[model samples]
Target: MTNYKRKKLDAFLSLSFCRLLSVIYIVHLPHLDATIEVTLRSMVASTFSMEYPKANRSFTSMSHLRRQLLPKTKDMPSGTGFGLMRLFTRKSPRSHSSKKKLPAGEQESESTTSTMSSTETTSIHRYDSGRRYNARQDIPYLLPNDEEENDRAHQQHWMINVAFGSNFDAPVQDALEKGIEVLDSGCGPATWTLEMAEKYPNSTFNGTDISPRFPQTIKPPNCHFFIHNIVDPAPFPDSTFMFIHQRLLSLGILENEWDKALADLMRTLKPGGWIELLEISYAQYENAGPKVTLLMQSVVTYGKSKGLNPGAAHVLDDMLTQAGAVNISSRRVAIPLNHGGKLGDLFWDDFKDIFMALYPVVGRLHSDLADIEEYKRFLDACKTECSEHQTALYWYRSCGQKPSNDE
Candidate 1:
């Protein structure tokens, strides 16, 4: 072959190689392995507009190609090698040190480490202090005690009860059979306590909340209600109770606050006792009715705007696992939140009826409810839907237990 033709063929091969290298590194290598090699490859491909596949071959066959294209290298590029080397092996300015030591007068620069440590300590203290302030301010709103109807604690209790439905009865039976005593932290209105006491007279149930919404007339012999705020540690002694249950408490808890709360619950449980937690993970909804998804999305957005944790839905599993809970299991229940299910379907009928009763409570709580009229129309449609077909709302239930023996 002529020198000119061979040179052209080599040039074409070089371009093809560059493209190949770029693709493999950019799209494939990073996924296959998380190493400094992939990072370096990314730097090269991104810094230069060289296609990845071509770059891959150029990188692999560089030694042989370098000898073949010696004449072209001199005329073709000067900074390419230096650029690639710099990209592949970056040096930190902060890490580099000068050979010359500091003068005696400048020896105090060593204390910069101490200065940074002190600054970090101060920053952490300030952050914690700010959180304390926010929590205190939020407590009154989160756990309001006023009895004039539509109160925060009342609404939360109702929401939780409706959320659990028949599943609540099963747990009460299980706890009773297991001879478990319950400390219902942040309990409002003593609904579960009252019901459990009636159903399981042998098992003891204690309900505590910052709010004093305990029903005077609904008192049961086996059930007791108290006032306690979980912002501080629970007042009960460690390893005392058999089972502890809490639900629908995300509004009152910030992220990671559940750790101390769970630890406290575990501490309160006996060695062989269980602790059950049920949270309505508001984010997991599928096959939602027409306005349900929109309303849910709006509510989630508004919750975030109001400084609530929209991510609270999925954090419970991690939180429970982190808190040393064992035998963790979760179930996702899909209930249609709209007005389009048959009365013959038990879950759907109850779901529609509950939404009709509860959406007004939600409307009272949220000022940004433009769909109030639409909600009513949907309720009427739900009534019609309930008579015709089966549809319902849904929620997720996750439960975990503390270890029987930490040893």
Candidate 2:
């Protein structure tokens, strides 16, 4: 082949190889450690830029391709890896160490104050056991705030919808259809919020969580998200929302804090509006195997040590009644795991993810499975036991209405 043709062929082949590697890395990004991911991105960007110095457009196109191909959850952050990709193209700033230090007794300037705030915001999330968790000491959430957990939350949303045959059981469909204000407290990932917003465009929906894992961009006009802990007082004014919903916060709310949390929900709820809460019966699985029982018991013991109520679902009715709510009602559903076909399979996967995410705490609480690999093996055994024993999880949906002024 001529030199010109040979050079062109070599360039094309090199570019193709780099593109293949990019696709592979992107496909496995969720499973990769953060350090490994950064290394892989750096390698790809360096190699691609070196071979195709004038191909910056190609690199940008690759970013778009990656965004499109990655599995999308309702709360997937937009332009997730684009910022990392930009690091390769831009020049690094001078080291802060080289700057003059502030004199003693000298307060930081506005710019420095804003920079520190940004740093603190980033530090709100910390990594443990390869999972990203909310680092705020006040918010006692047990799950990780990472994409894997978001995916699991999304799956759990659909599973609950199917099991209960609706997103909610309260008698607020007419109000929602006609346009009403709704709150989804402790709304991890905002999966349910987004779905409900789309279903009832007239209704406005607000989602709040301690972690900012919900989608920042790419949400319906009626849907909004805020970073607020429900343990604190309600951020909204009194009687602001026509309906309030909270789910699965049994792990986050302390046993003694249940009254306060419910009171906060009731405070934001409009008089005569409905408040609904859905929670799993922690450590109360039916037909549990020996291994399953042991693991669950460990979870309950660990939760109790933190003052969390593992059996919060059982007392929802009494709590609502004490909170001055009227017409309280509760429903129960049994979700089969590992034996009920597709629904069971989905629930099993969700359970496994939960187990994996709790490793940091469970491993410490149970010394026998301190090593992660061994814990995983133990998890596999639990899965087998679940299938053999026909394990089932129960969920409670409790709802009540605030008394109107005339009442």
Candidate number achieving the greatest TM-score relative to the actual structure: 2
lDDT digits (tens) for residues 105-219 of candidate 1? 4322211222111111121111110111112344522222322121223223434444556435223466586566778776665555655555666787888876566653234
Q: How far does residue 143 in candidate 2 sit from its true spot (Å)?
A: 1.2
Task: Summarize candidate 2's per-residue lDDT along 1-407 as a digit string, tens digits.
Answer: 96535654665666666677666775686798867766766565445432221231222223322333334434345555434332222221222112233334544332222211121123345445555667577777788886567657766777788799999989999999999999999888777787788778899999998888776754566888898888889779999998999999988998889888888888888899999999998767799988888777877888999999888888889889989899999999999988887678768878887988787677777787877678889999988998999999889999999999999
Report the lDDT of model 2 for residue 325: 94
Candidate 1 worst ten-residue window by lDDT: 124-133
The most accurate candidate by lDDT is 2
Per-model TM-score versus the true fold = 0.52, 0.72
Q: What is the model-wide C-alpha lDDT for candidate 1?
A: 0.48
Show the lowest summed lDDT stretch of 10 residues, model 2: 112-121
Which parts of model 1 have CA positions greater than 4 angstroms off? 1-136, 140-175, 338-392
lDDT values, one for every candidate: 0.48, 0.73
